[model samples]
Target chain A: MESILQSLISGIVVGSIYALIALGFVLIYKSTAVINFAQGELLMFGAYLCLTLVVVLQVPFWLAFLGTLIAAALLGFFLERLFLRPMIGEPAISIIMLTIGLASLMQGIIHMTWGSETRVYPAIFPVEPLRFGGMVVSQVYLYSVLFAVVCLILFNLFFRYSSSGIAMRAVANDQQAAQSMGISIKKIFAIAWAIAAVVAGVGGILIGNINGVNASLSSFGLKVFPAVILGGLDSIPGAILGGFIIGLLEALSGMYLDPLFEGGSKEVVPFVILVVVLMIKPYGLFGTEEIEKI
Target chain B: MAVKCGVFKTTYRDDEAIWQTKVSKFWLALLLIALLAFPFVFQGSRYLLYVVNSVFIAVIAAIGLNILTGFTGQISLGHGAFMGVGAYCSGYFMTTLGMPFLVCVVAAGCVTAIVGMIFGIPSLRLKGLYLAIATLAAQVILEFVFVRWRGVTGGSQGMLVPPASIGGLTFNSDFKFYFLALAFTILTVMIAKNIVRTKPGRAFMAIRDRYISAEIIGVPLFQYKLISFGISSFYAGVAGSLWGHYIGIITPEHFNVMISIQYLSMIIIGGLGSIHGTIMGAVFMTLLPEVLRVISGLFSGQYPVLVNIFGAIRESVFGLVIILFLIFEPDGLAARWKTIQNYWKLWPFSY
Candidate 1:
C-alpha cells in the first residue's frame, strides 16, 4: 500500500512536467494544426539555455530561467516567421516534413553548441525529503509539481481573459471563420508559437529539476505524442490530464510489467495505449470531430 | 534497323509499347544485360556486390513505400518498422523452424502484410498528421518488441541470418546475393508498375486526389485503401527479407525512423507518383550519404569543425534541397532530368 502510494506520488511529479510539455505541444498544434516534432528539442534548448546562463555566465537561477524563456519564445516566433509561415497553404506532407526538418535543424544546432555530454543541473530547491505519514517526496520533485501547476494556472487565466488568448482560441476553432471575425490568423500563429515556447521553457526547468539536463531530453518530445493523443489534440485541459495518466502508466509499467516482460517493454507501453486509443477513439477524450468536405 | 517503328510512331498501346520509348528499350535492355554481367566481370569482389545488392533492396522498399504514400496519398512514417517486421519474421522462420529460404521470403512478406493491415485499420479514418501519428505509433511499438522479445527477436543485438539457397545451392557469395536482390527488385518493380496501371491502381489515384469525391463516385474506401496497404506492405516485406538475407545479419538499428525518412526523401526527390522517380530516388539517396561522406572527408582536414558541421550540413542541405525542389521543380529530380534529356534529344530542331 505504501509502495503504491509512493508510486502514485512519484508518477504525479513526473507527470506534471510531461503535462506542461504536452500543453506546449497542444497549444502549437491548436493554432497551426501541425505537430511540432521540434517541441522536445525546444524544451531541451530552453533547459540548456538556462544552464548556460546559470552555470557559464554565473547568472542567478531565476534570471536565467526568465532569459531562457524569452529566448525560447523568440526562437519559436522566429520559426513561425521563417519556416512555418511558408507552410501555411502547403500540403499536410510539407508542413510535417518542414517541422521534421526544423527538429533535425534544432538537433544539429544543439549538438554544435553543446556537445552531447550529460550535465548535472544545480538544484535550486532544498535537498531534504518532505515526509508525510508513510510517504516521502523529494523537495525538487515537489517544487516541480508546484511550479508547473502555478504556470498552468497563470496560462489558464491568460486564456480566459486576455484578448490575444481569446483570438488564439478563435483561430484554433476555425481559421477562416476566425479571420472573418477580424482576428489576424497570422498573429495568432505567432502568438501560439510564442506561448508554446514559454510553456516548453517552464516544462524544461521543471524536467531539469527531475531528470537533469541533456540533449536526450529532446526524446521526451516524442514521448509527449502519446500523452497529447490520449488527452485529445484540441483540448488543453485534456493534455494536462493525459500527461498524468501517461506518466502514471509509465511508472506502473516500469515497476510491475517490466520485470515480467524483461526486455524494456514499459518504454513502449504508452505507444501501445496511443495506437489502441486512436484506433478506438479517433477523436480522443475531448477532441471535436472534424467534418471534411469533398 | 527495322525497329518496331509502327509501335513507336504517334502512339502505342500499353501492351505494345516498348520499355518507355522505342529508343529507350534498347538502352534499358543493354543496361540490364550489362548489370547482370558486371558482377561476374568483377572477378567476385564481394564488397561491390554487397553495395549493389543493397541498392536493389532499397529500391524494393522505396517502391513499396511509394505505393502507399504516393499512389494512395497515405503517409506512412513507420515503414522502417514494417521492413524490420519482415526482416525479423523471415530471419526467425529460417533460423528456427528451418524453413526453406523461398518459404521464408513468402512468410516474411505475409507476416508484414498482416501487421500492416493491423496498422492500416486506423488509417481508414485518419488522414494528414493524424495518420502519420498512427503509423509512427506502430514504429514505436515494433521497436519495443525488437528490444524486448529476446526469445523471438534476439533483443537489441538482433539475429544472424543463414546463407539462403534456392533448392540446394547456398548464396554464400556476394555475387549470388546480388543476383538474388537484382532479380527480386526487378520482379517487384514490374509487379508494382502493372499494379499502378490497373483499375484498382486508378482507384488509389482517385482516392489520393480526393477521398470524399472518390467515395461519392462509388469507390469503396475500406477495400481499396486496405488493398494499398496490403500490397505496399508486401513490397516492404519482400525488400526487408531480401535485406536480411543479403546482409547475412539483421539488427533493430538498421530500421529506425531515420530509415523511414530516407525512404520518404527518396520518393520526394525522385517524384512522388512516377515509377521512374521512385527508382531514381532510391538509387540517388542510397548513394548520396556515401558520396557526401567521401566528399566531406576531402575537406574535413581543412575545417576542423567539419565533423561538427556534418549533421547540420546534411540536415539543412537536405531540407533546403526538399524545399527548393518543391518550389522550383516540384516534379522532382527524375521528371526534371527527363525533360532536360528530351531537350537534348531534340537539339537543333525547335518543336
Candidate 2:
C-alpha cells in the first residue's frame, strides 16, 4: 500500500511534466494543424540553455529560467517564420518533414555544443526527500509537479481570457473563416509557436531536474505523443489528462509489470496504448473530429 | 543507326517498351556493361567498391520508402523497424535453419511484408501525420523488442550473420558483394518501375492524389494501402538482408528513427514518386556524410575546433539540406533532372 502510494505520487509528478510538453504539441497542432516533431528538441534546447546559464555561467536559477523562456519564445517565433512560413501551402507530409528536419538540426546543434556526454543538473532546491506518513517523494519531483500545475493553470487562464488566445482559437476553428473575420492567421501561428516553446522550455527544466540533460530528453518529448494523442492533439485539457494517465501507466508498469515481464514492459506499454488508442479513437477523447469534404 | 536523336513510336508495343527510344536502350546496355565491369576496372580501390555496395542497398530501401510515402501518400516513420525485421529474420534463418542465401533473403522479405501489412492496417482510419505517428509507435515498440527479446534477437548485443555463399563461391570480399548488390539493385529497380507503370501503381497514385475520390471510383483503400506497405517492406527486407550479410551483424541500433529519417530525406530530396529519384536520393544521402568528412578533414588541420564539432556540423547540415529541399525543390532531384534532360533533348530551341 505504501509502495502504491509512492508510485502514485511519482507518477503524478512525471505526468505533469509530460503534460507540460504535450501542451506544446497541442498548442502547435491546434493553431497550424501540424504536429511539431521538434517539441522534444525544443525542450532539450531550453534545458541546455538553463544548464549553461545557471551552472556554467553561475547565474541565478530564476534568472536563467527567465532567459531560457525568452530564448525559447524567440526560437519558436523564428522557426515558424523562417522554415515553416515558406511551406505555407505545401502538402501535409512536406510540413511534417520540415519539423523533423528542424528536430534533427536541433539535435545536431546540441550534440556539437554539449558533446554526447550526459550531465547531472545542478541542485537548485534542497536535496531532502519529502514524506507524508509512509509515502516519500523527492524534493525535485515535488517542485516539478508544483511548477507544472502552476504553469498549466496560468496557461488555462491565458487561453480563456487573452485576445490572442481567442484569435488562436478562431484560426484553429477554420482558417478561411478566421481570415474572413479579419483574424491574422500568421500572427496566431507565431503566437502558438511561441507559447508552445515556452511550455516546452518549462517542461525541459522540470525533466532536467529529475533525470539530467541529454539527447534522450528529446525522446522524452516523443514519449509525450501518446499523451497528446490520448488527450486529443488539439485539446489543452486533454493533453494534461493524457499526461497523467501515461505517467500512471509508466509508473504502474515499472512497479508491477516489469517484475513479471523481466523488464522492458514499461517503455513498451505507452506505445501499446498508443496503437490501441489510435485504432479505437484516432481523434482522441477531447479532439475535434475533422469532417473532410470529398 | 537506330540510336538517333529523333524517334517516333509507331505501335502500342513500341510505346509500352521499358526503353522507348533506341538511344535509351543502348545507354542502358552500356550502363549495365559498365556496372558489370566496374569491379574489374577498380580492382585496387576497396573503398570505392564498399561505397558503391552500400549505395546499392540504400537505393533498394529508398525505393521501398518511395512506394509507400511517394506513390501511396501514406507517410511512414517506422521504415527502419521494418528493415530491422528483415535483417533479424534473415540472420535467424541463415544461422539457425541453415538456409541458402537466396532463399533466406526472399523469405526475409516475405516475413517483413507480412509485418508491414499488419502495421499498415492503421492506415484504414489514420492518414498523413497521424499514420506517421502510428508508424513511429511501431518503430519504438520494435526497437524495444529488438533490445528485450533475448532469445530470438540475441538481445542488445546483436546477432552475427553468416557470409552469403552459393555454389562454392562466397561473397565475403567487396568485389564479389558488389556484383551481388548490383544484381539485387537492378532487380529491385525493375520491380519498382513495373509497379509504377502498371495498374496497381496507378491505383496508388489515385489514392495519393485523392483518397476519397479513389475510393468512390472503386479502388479498395485498405487493400492498396496494405499492398503498398507489403511491396515497400519487401524491398526493405531484401535491402536489410543484403545489409546484414554485407555487414556480418545485426543490431537494433543499426535501424532506428535516424535511419527512417534518412530514408525519408532520400525520397524527399531525391524526388517523391520518381524511381530514378530514389536512386539519386539514396546515392546523395549515403555519400553526404563522407563528403562532409573529407571537407572537415581538410579544414580540421587548420582549425582544431572543426575536429571537435564535425559531428554536429554534419548533422545540422543534413537537416538544413532537407529544409532547403522542402522549401525550394519539393519535387526533388528528379524534377530538376527532367528539366535538364528536356533542355538537352530540345537543344537550342528549348522552351
True lDDT of residue B160, candidate 2: 95
Error of 1 at A143 (Å): 1.8
TM-scores for all predictions: 0.93, 0.97
Tens digits of per-residue lDDT, candidate 2, A1-294, equal 988888888889889999999998999988898889899999999999999999889999999999999999999999999988888888999998999999889999999888878887888988988778756778998899999999999999888899888888889888999999999999999999999999999999988989998888998778988999899888999999999999999999999989876897878899999999999999999998888975
Show pairs that collide, candidate 2.
none
lDDT of 1 by residue, B210-263 (tens): 998899999998899998898889888888988888787888899888788778
Those runs of model 2 whose alpha carbons end farther than 4 Å from true positions after fitting are B1-10
Specify the poorest-scoring 10-residue window by lDDT in model 1 chain B.
Answer: B1-10
Q: What is the fnat of candidate 2?
A: 0.81
DockQ of each: 0.47, 0.76
RMSD of 2: 1.8
| Local accuracy of candidate 2 as per-residue lDDT tens digits, B1-351 | 333343467899998888877667888899999999999999899988988999999999999999999999999998999999999999999999999999999999999999999999999999887899999999889888888888998888999998888779899999999988998999899989999989999999999999999999999999999999999999989999999999998988999989999999999999999999989999999999988988998988889999888878988999999999999899999999988877766555565
Off by over 4 Å in 1: B1-18, B37-48, B303-331, B341-351
